[model samples]
Target: MLGERILLGPGPSLVPPEVTAAMAAPMVGHMDPDLFPVLEETARLLRQVFQTANELTLAVSGTGTAGMEATLLHMVKPGERLVVCSAGFFADRLIEIGGRIGAEVVRVEAAWGRPIDPADLERALGRLGGGRTTVAAVHVETSTGVLHPIADLARVAHAHDAAILVDAVASLGGADLPTDAWDLDACYSGSQKCLSAPPGMAPVTVHTRTRGRFRPATFYLDLEGLWTYWGAPHGYHHTVPVSLVYAMREALRLVAAEGLPARVERHRRMTRALWAGLEAMGLELLVPEPHRSPTITTVRIPAGADDAKVRTRLLREYSIEIAGGLGPLRGQIWRIGLMGYSCQPKWVLALLGALEAVLTAEGVRLPKGDAARAAAARL
Candidate 1:
């Protein structure tokens, strides 16, 4: 049997027992009367977490990418302009998906480990001259652990008369992103990240202004169609995973009980401790402090340390799971996530101590016995 593992990767953060127990409740038919209220309550909780008053809020039945494709498919028409702020792996995904949908995709790129500058985005949109254009950005670039300024970018897009869509797959409940306050036309996130739920549902909110702009090319991901089923009449659109909805509802309740402000602070505090621990062990972080993500942290592999070996040892010996970098950053850095229920001081200190030991065993030089102490001091 596989051992119980600590999930400290980019996603699928440690699911709390309450969420799992909620999922274990007996399943109900998708169209059953009992399920409608549950769906309604879930959408209400999603709005609380998303900090949006948009009526078009619901959970898609697929993962985070499903939510991404839904917003793009609905908002961008063929030959329309889609401006994507490219910096890391997930941002490139926006560019790729836009192109595949036959949109004229443009990129406002920044260095991988750096946040996109709103001024750069402003200039790019200025040149586009805005006609049915959409600006897309990743709120938290999971691959690089950088948090872009979504509100500022949204303002820039609006200034150019363009609609803005945000991929908050890695931010959502873990970080502060006020959907309505930011004026994002659409925003979507994954259940597995900061929501402390399993990997199926993708919570999405579409501003009223974004509705009816264009008919989505696909039926399943159509935002308005999904909303119709989740709202007033509660008509059937598709067979959503009833159990997963249960899990999402419970997880969202947990988010509400802890309160978003406290939860965000906890994530920040834990990240600071982790940063202190890693730095004390003579490690370098990828993203600069100002732009770093509260939930995910990317650390540079020491010159002599093997990225694959270190991660493997972490999993096999310590029963902890963190991830390596993607795309051009492969073998260059480690991605450590402290999200949702996993964002605890104990886990932060535990990973620091375990990582220090593994690096030492790998013959990597470090200030012996300093990592955990530094992290504890901050905690």
Candidate 2:
């Protein structure tokens, strides 16, 4: 028996109704003229969402990781030095991918639950001594729910003459990321996270400078090849995922209709409400308030409380699903994602209500009704 449960994890967050409906629409041939317009519209909308006027904005037929691979494969060649900021899992993944591409990977490390400091990044770049250092960072670290200072990082990278790539898998639509304004060269995001769409398409944008410098080292994941195929002559690189493109187009349209600024504000409001409710329940947040991501919040479970038990009860009894921590934080943190449509006030209140009951029943001490009341007060 399938049960209806609220998706409150890092991703694949709740899909908007329109996106789902669009995906259900009839699929068309990848090279059909009618479908070409849809592809073009998708690229245009992605450029708008990414806040870039780049000529090569497009979607890849894979998940966010494919976008990451594509960016590294094209931008960083063998024997070049690539500097990566490691604050969490995604950053580590970037370093790994860079290593696989035969780039000399240098890491600027930060503690698991902390954001990478701009000074540290500068120091790392200084140690690398300039030439061939491609700086990479995770804009929003989903593993720890920490928001890195991308603008400052970009400034530091630019000073060293390094092109910066951002993995915005969790931040793209939910947070304010102005690619051009921030001077980010290349960035990739997933459809399932803040886009409120299914998880097949990876939306990516590359600056003109990056595009001009990039060389295709791999055929399938080559950004330059994909760009040329999608642009101008529109030569075929690969058969595009038709339904996923439809979903992305619809999702981007919803984002356009809502306006990026207003959508970001809504996410902020819902996140604040979740934070307030968790605070009222006496749960401690993993990251400091200044570094928290608006899309996801990681709360530290109280000492001696069973994390698995609490999460299981929330799922089985209340039909609500939150997440446990990753890596070193596995059993210590509860990740509550207020992403896209799931970032609604109703979901926040409902999650808090369910969590309160579960924790209270688990023999944790907290005043009854405080969490829901605190969340409501925020609303």
Top lDDT prediction, candidate number? 1
Model 2's TM-score against the true structure: 0.97
lDDT of 2 by residue, 292-311 (tens): 99999999998768999999
lDDT of 1 by residue, 120-156 (tens): 9988887776478899999999999999999899999
TM-score for each model? 0.99, 0.97
Off by over 4 Å in 2: 212-214
What total of clashing residue pairs does each candidate reach?
0, 0
Q: Please list the C-alpha lDDT of all candidates, in the order they appear.
A: 0.93, 0.88
